[model samples]
Structure formats: C-alpha cells, structure tokens
Target: MAEELQTATDKLEDEHYPAYTMGRAAEMLGTTPGFLRSLDEVKLLVPQRSRGGHRRYSRYQLRLATRVRALVDEGTGLEAACRIVILEDQLEEARRINAEHSSHQPER
Candidate 1:
C-alpha cells in the first residue's frame, strides 16, 4: 500500500504526468478555457483526455501553452505562436541530444 502511494506521488511529480484538468490548467495559467481549446484546435499542445473524455494537461504542455500565450499577447498570430513554440521545443531537444552525444564521445 505504501509503495502504491509512493508511486502515485512520483507520478504527480513528473512533468509529463497529465495531472491538471482543462479548467484547472487554465486557471493556473491565468487564461481562459477557450484559449486552451484554441491551442488544442491548432495542434499546439494536444492534451490527453481523462477517462470521461475531458482534456487533461501536463506541466510540460502547460509551459508550452504559456509560451504561446505570451507570444500571442505580444501580437503574434496563434498559428505563428504555435510554430515558434514548436521550433523552440525542437531546438531544445536537439541541444539536449547534442549534449548527450558530446558527453559520450571519447576525447582526443
């Protein structure tokens, strides 16, 4: 029982865990549910759905949403903002991969 509880707590701590409902996620980001739906409509951050078919978001996805929202607030179009965020995420992932590769390479 204790192990199960610990595992559940670990899941909550994971950034990829879909821990927040759409409404709660919007409230946390100070945005409206409509905005989150727009993000979803654009395929920016397609959240996982709950057992009942409600959208559930992870912390990682929420951060991406926040970035897109910031760009939109600064006058960028929704599609453009999503593209920028996608590129940023790609760059970060590439950098992470490069760093791992560099670390694994033997020095001359």
Candidate 2:
C-alpha cells in the first residue's frame, strides 16, 4: 500500500503525466475550454484521453499552451502561434542534442 501511494505521488512529479483535466488545464492557462480544444484542432498539443474519453493534459503540454497563450495575447494568430511553438520546441531539442554530442567529442 505504501509503495502504491509512493508511486502515485511520484507520478505527480512527472512532467509528462496526464494529471490535469481539460477544464482544470484551461483554468490554469487562464483560457477557456474552447481555446484548449482549438489547440487540439490545430494539432499543436494533443492531450491524452482518460478512460471515459475526456482530454487530460500534462505539465509539459501546459507549458506549450502557456507559450501559445502569450503569443496569442501579443496579437499572433492561433495557427502561427502553434507553428512558432513547434519550431521553438524543435530548436530546443536540436540544441540539446548538439550540446550532448559536443560534450562527447574528443579534444582537438
């Protein structure tokens, strides 16, 4: 029982865990459910679905949503904002990979 409880607690710390329901996620982002749904429509941040088929979001998804929200607030179009976020994510990943590769290279 203690192990189960610990595992549940550990999941909460996981950034990829689908811990927040749509409504809660929207509320956290200061947006409406419709906005989140729009994100899914645009194929930006497709959240996980619960057993009953309700959308559930992870902390990483919320971070992406927050970036989109900021862009939209700054007068960017929804589709453009999603594109920018995708590019940004890709660039970050590429940079991470490059850094890791550099660290493993032998000295000149």
Candidate 3:
C-alpha cells in the first residue's frame, strides 16, 4: 500500500511525466488548444502522443507553454515568443552549468 502511494506521489512530482491531456494543459496555462498546437508546430514544446493519438503534456511542457503565453499576451508573435522562451531556458541552463563548473574549480 505504501509503495503504491509512493508511486502516486512520484508521478505528481515528476515534471517529465506525461500526465496531462492537451486540453487540461491548455486550461492550466489559461490558453487554448490551438495555442498549444502552435507551440508544437514551432517545435518549442512538443507534447507526447498517447496510444490513442491524443497529445499528452508533461508539467515541464506546460510551464514552457505558460511562459510562451505570457509573451504572447504581451503582444509578441507566437513564433517569436517560442524563440524567446527557448532562448531564456537555454540561457538559464547554461548559467547553471557555468555556476556549477566555477564552484568545482580549485582556488587559483
């Protein structure tokens, strides 16, 4: 019983788990399914497809969609918003890697 509970908890915690349908993800992001489709079209946040061919969104993808929605709400074009969001994510990752590398360097 505890193991089953833990499995459920882990699924909730996993950002990469495809636990949300496209419609749910769109609703969570306060956007439309068409908007989510545009993100997939731009290859910015391609959601996984279920066995029945329905799109399944991970938490990570929803977050990306939220960011893009914010930009789009600010009057940015969809394609440009996707590009900005992708660049921002890449920049954040690069910064994290640089910080980790710097922290591990020996005093010089």
Winner by TM-score: 1
Task: Rank candidates, TM-score, best first.
Answer: 1, 2, 3
Report, for all candidates in order, the number of backbone clashes.
Answer: 0, 0, 0
Instruction: Go through the candidates in order and give the C-alpha RMSD of each one to the true structure.
Output: 0.8, 1.2, 1.5
Compare candidates 1 and 3 on lDDT and give the better one: 1
Question: Which candidate achieves the best lDDT against the true structure?
Answer: 2
> What is the Cα-based lDDT of residue 22 in candidate 1?
93
For model 3, residues 1-108, the per-residue Cα lDDT tens digits are 999999999999999999999889888888789988988888997788999999999988888888988988999998899989989999999999999999999998
lDDT of 3: 0.91
Q: How close is every model to the real structure, measured as TM-score?
A: 0.96, 0.93, 0.89
- What candidate 3 gets wrong by more than 4 Å, as runs, is 1-5
lDDT (0 to 1) per candidate: 0.96, 0.97, 0.91
**What does candidate 3 score in Cα RMSD to the true structure?**
1.5
Q: How big is the positional error of residue 106 in model 2, measured in Å on the Cα after superposition?
A: 1.9
lDDT for model 2, please: 0.97
Tens-digit lDDT string for candidate 1 (36-59): 999999998889988899999999
